[model samples]
Target: MGDTGESQIKSGQGYPVLKPVGDSAICIEFGDEINDRVNDLVYSAADALNARSPSWLRELVPTYRSLLVHYDALAADYDEVRSDLLGLAASDSAAETSSSGGARQVFELPTVYGGEFGPDLDAVASHAGLDSEDVVRIHSSIAYRVYMIGFAPGFPYLGGMDQSIATPRLATPRTRVPAGSVGIAESQTGVYPAASPGGWQLIGQTPVQLFDAQAQPPSVLQPGHFVKFVPVDESEFQRIQAEVANGQYRVAHSEFAS
Candidate 1:
């Protein structure tokens, strides 16, 4: 669809700022804070934009509250592209605060908490005035929303963490955090996805490969997905790891309309 197409989506709350990024890109800021409602709008806008992308539209990157769109400066004029995007931002369907185009999948991820895998678990618990088991119980109880997939390949920036067990990041960044490590920083908790240097407080580890370069889409999770942690023992962790390596393990997920 071109910029002249009728807007089918309803308008959302707040005004979107269309800011230019350097020479070849634009960043559409939806809001400031990290929230589900705002992200839904971003997701919808991205879905709608990509669906009816102009020839100048190069790449669309959706984040917590903005959509970074890169255009071909050589093939298209920036002002024309800007006007087209402005038209999209003004569209009712794009303005609608919904992720209609994105498919949301609920994942039940198996994780092993404490001991060597979760070195900072006890320390974090002690700081929170609670035991390690209480920390695990509380952490695993909530179904976290995947706000965005960034940092490492499939590393999720998850929201909906329990306020009770909230903890800050490590003062000193670790040289290397192993892949599959689950960590919490302030009000957020997320998996490591891959081994990398990180500062988030480590709490657990998962055997599931969050990102597989050889896989069709690579990343296992997406922005609209909800992740549920299923605590598993060390033995089960080992078994799952082996199964995954042998390509016999299936990651359990369910599809439901949001």
Candidate 2:
């Protein structure tokens, strides 16, 4: 989409900044920082737009602190759409949508830390000035929020990792990191959904299949969801792997107030 000459527009105080992202899309920025409150606004905007069900609406892509709205330029006037977006942004419903305490799905991922599966576990532990066992305990202690799914298919960019175990990425990225490999890079922790080159510190590996082409809504993880790592033994990992391969395993999940 080519950039339209439309200048940035603000709906007023507390509302998002709407900027034209080419001729067919608009970037609705909620805030300048990456945090839960800003993310909630992004989700709220998306929810409000979807509820309106405008014919011109094509897709709503929610990012860390903004919502990208794609529209059918031929069917709808840009000014009208912009006005509608501003109206929604300033409405009480939009604020209420975000403030409503709703349940968010939390997936429990069983992981096996260290050994062959996690080649960089020792390096990570050494960097953190702690033992491998302590590293594992600290890593799995809290539930992480899935900020956005990108970089690779079903790959979740997670947040809320304890800074104590934070480690930098590999000096030289591996040519190929195995799928289901859980890695820590700086303050973020995420799982490699498929076999691909990556640089995150490999501390653990989960047996869950993150992406399955044959299944409906292939990606097991979704944006705005939570992931809780459950450390498992080698035997348990093997059992879960076998079950996953046979299409019998179901990732343990529950709902918690967001």
Candidate 3:
């Protein structure tokens, strides 16, 4: 949103270190906070660099406060890759582009908020100092921003949570958090794209599969998209779940092109 020019500003040593995760991947870290400003800048540069990535580049992974850009050591040396990363870090121009703005998608996630579907719903309500219905309303009120997709395939790291509804993770992690398990942790809320072991505070679950390996994009949602959880009754949840089980769920796409 400001000047998009290269700056020699350096993240102090031990602050935002660029280290090699593996033989081919290098991570560029920003800081510790998961604020809007930090994630926005990171995703902006990532989108721009990804749009015109070099031939040696393999994959670009964006996290809350860092970016993992994997490249070939044979075709491109570390120095060359570092130099490219420096340019990306310095330039603010990419963040100013129209495409860099909030690329939000409004998703109507049909969820079953209580009962077995949401075991921690009552706990969350107690922790938030509100009734169960109030908790559900507050949780579903905001249009959450998809910070980054990681942890599991198509798992969107959502932000813009109502602090009133914010709660810590479960003391003991669950063995199996089914796909579509909507949960909140710290100041963020997200869905379990696939069945996985997790510790987030479960509040509800959606019927749609966030990911499908057979689909073109695989994920129904992506980073920079917006999500709005729409609470539905048990019957509707069963109906949608049945559709997904039978491969009849109508997956919606975001208006990202505009």
Would you give me the overall lDDT of model 1?
0.84
TM-score of each: 0.90, 0.91, 0.84
Considering every candidate listed, which one attains the maximal lDDT? 2
Number of colliding residue pairs in model 1:
3
Model 1 TM-score relative to the real fold: 0.90
Query: Pairing residues by index, what is the TM-score of model 2?
Result: 0.91
Clashing pairs in 2: none
Tens-place lDDT digits, model 3, residues 15-103: 44578787788888775566555566667767777876788799888887788889998988888888877776667465546555544
Tens digit of per-residue lDDT, candidate 2, span 134-166: 999999998888877877779998888888889
Rank by TM-score (best first) = 2, 1, 3
Off by over 4 Å in 3: 1-23, 88-95, 252-258
Instruction: Give each model's clash number.
Output: 3, 0, 4
RMSD of each: 5.8, 5.9, 4.4
